[model samples]
Target: MLKRLFKLGLIINPYSGIGGALALKGSDGADIRQQALIRGAEKLSGKRMAIALQALLPLKNELSIYTASGEMGEDILSSMGFNHVVVYQHQAQQTESADTKAAALELIAQAVDLILFAGGDGTARNICEVVENHCPVVGVPAGCKIHSGVYAITPKAAGQVVAQVIKGELVSLMSGEVKDIDETEFRAGRVIAKHYGEMLVPEELRYIQAVKMGGKESDELVLSDIAAHVIELMDDEPDTLFVMGSGSTVDSIMQELGLSNTLLGVDLVRGQQLLANDLTAASLLEHCANKPVKIVLTLIGGQGHILGRGNQQLSPELVKMVSKQNILVVATKSKLQSLQGRPLVSDSGDTTLDEMLVGPIPVITGFHDLVLYSVGSM
Candidate 1:
């Protein structure tokens, strides 16, 4: 009798994170990808896929892999010495969302037990379009805005979840959301995140990221109090450069200071004066350099992410520039209570920084009020 091998499907969006570091803000269009490449951005989806696949090395002989041809899948699997069958061939040199959907359909046809893909929310949307609830999938976080619940908190965690499934361990299945935002509105400092649909995913609370909570803060009184406290601080430190992060909580502060805020983008202010609006990563680094900078941030409602969800503008370099002590977090008491005691997450894509950020930090809940909370990364 022969052992029945665990069959796994793989798909890599080779251009997923190409526009992130370059400040293009998304990898959705071919023209955007070309712009990023011309500006010297390298495709990092393959490298991210490689990191996730590392954990499956020991179980190689006990598994069978299926994937798309070339950079979409085969290249990385081949480099990693995993024997895989190319189930679909991409028609164009540059892979599109259509390629991802086609590859997923082929994988379902092959009856793979689980599909593991690397990309952001856009990639998740493509997979959901074809697979729906037909097959389970795991996503590696490798895009500009990872505002979806389908992705693992980190690349290594993604592999670990897949490994559990491959080892025949008890991994629960649940519906993961496929959410995306209009890049046009996003670039214009507006966040209109909408739920496209859902897909069956292997559930691991420690590994899987939570879906980003949408809508605005409804407690007008609490928002006003929180905003007042932040304004008081700004008055006390007249010389400090304030970097306003995204979220309604921070936006409330901007409103109190009598300044227009970028609803879904980073802004800059000094002594209650608006200096800049909707800055990119490079712009942030240049402006924040050699200044006494303090970053005003707020956690994502249900996700508890203070960094690396939609605020990719706060790149690792910019975070380091401001230092951890200079970060001021504000959220309503009810908002913090909604997490039910899950620590805040800082999935900044830099393992070292994420580790460095682990500890208790102060959160301003109201006027002259603060509470200590823990921050962690998967």
Candidate 2:
């Protein structure tokens, strides 16, 4: 005989995107937060959450927010003058995955209509373990690498989607995969991704991103041809240093050269030998010091991102070392087709670098085949 107020849950992994601009590759655990900060990585999650929450301010009175204390959620909501209830407490600078899980549990107990989180795939994994379809959830893109389908295309998009839901719009729900990667291996230039599980997510097709699909076995032949083209280019300039960005297409080139490469991390090669196995932004800069270098990358399927998605190791500074003219883009015809006429995108977290990447760039789609495609901010 009682009606509950329309309630929504909020969680913020304050350190989510800290590792990105620092060129840490991925932001998964808490230990890297300090290292990121030391490297001048900004606390992007809070700022991003604020961006998302601002969209809901007009309807603040119609919905109530249940969230964790401090940086987790309360601080942002309070500052925005939104109506929110803190149901969980956490340490200021010591919040861990455990804290995220505990906060999710508390939010679920409060019978919130939906749970919106801010973080990367790892943060999604922690929440997936506790939520498990208990309520609808969404993600605000504020991480280094987001391979999960639950996230909005951008923080502003996330706010719009949540605002629509809070207004009682009839939005469908779907199960979104929670993708996780090994940070140690990732930093080592080896990407090992595993499916943790799935969670209920609000389906706003225009705003939400799809889960990152794995490299298909059928793409091997196409990759091999692409590799051959890159190898020939390398042979002509034996003295030039080639910085390899992660992806199966680029990995195929290393395989063709018979050199070991980090499939999910940056690698460096000089002539026919491997110069560096896996490299961070600092390591990349160190190795390429005073050396003429070129960057080789492949477009991310569906997303059409050539940088700033899963390849933070290729930082703007490193890109400067390589120079845009020396950068090589590789993709198969099918992969390019997946773009659906949209231009390739870049979000390297550096506004100037992203601007430099604007306009048409050549993409190697096959052996001796080049296609000029436009690059824009995502």
Q: How high is the CA lDDT of each candidate model?
A: 0.84, 0.79
Q: In candidate 1, what are the lDDT values of residues 2-92, reduced to their tens digit?
A: 4456779999999998999988889999999989988999999999999999999999998799999999999999999999999999989
The residue-level lDDT of candidate 1 at 270 comes to 92
Q: Tell me the TM-score of each prediction against the true structure.
A: 0.55, 0.53
In model 1, what are the clashing residue pairs, if there are any? none
Error of 2 at 293 (Å): 63
Q: How does residue 49 of candidate 2 score in lDDT?
A: 86
RMSD of each: 20.4, 20.6
Q: lDDT tens digits, residues 32-135, model 2?
A: 88778777777879898888888888888767789999999999888889888899999667688899999999997876767888998888989999998666
lDDT for model 2 comes to: 0.79
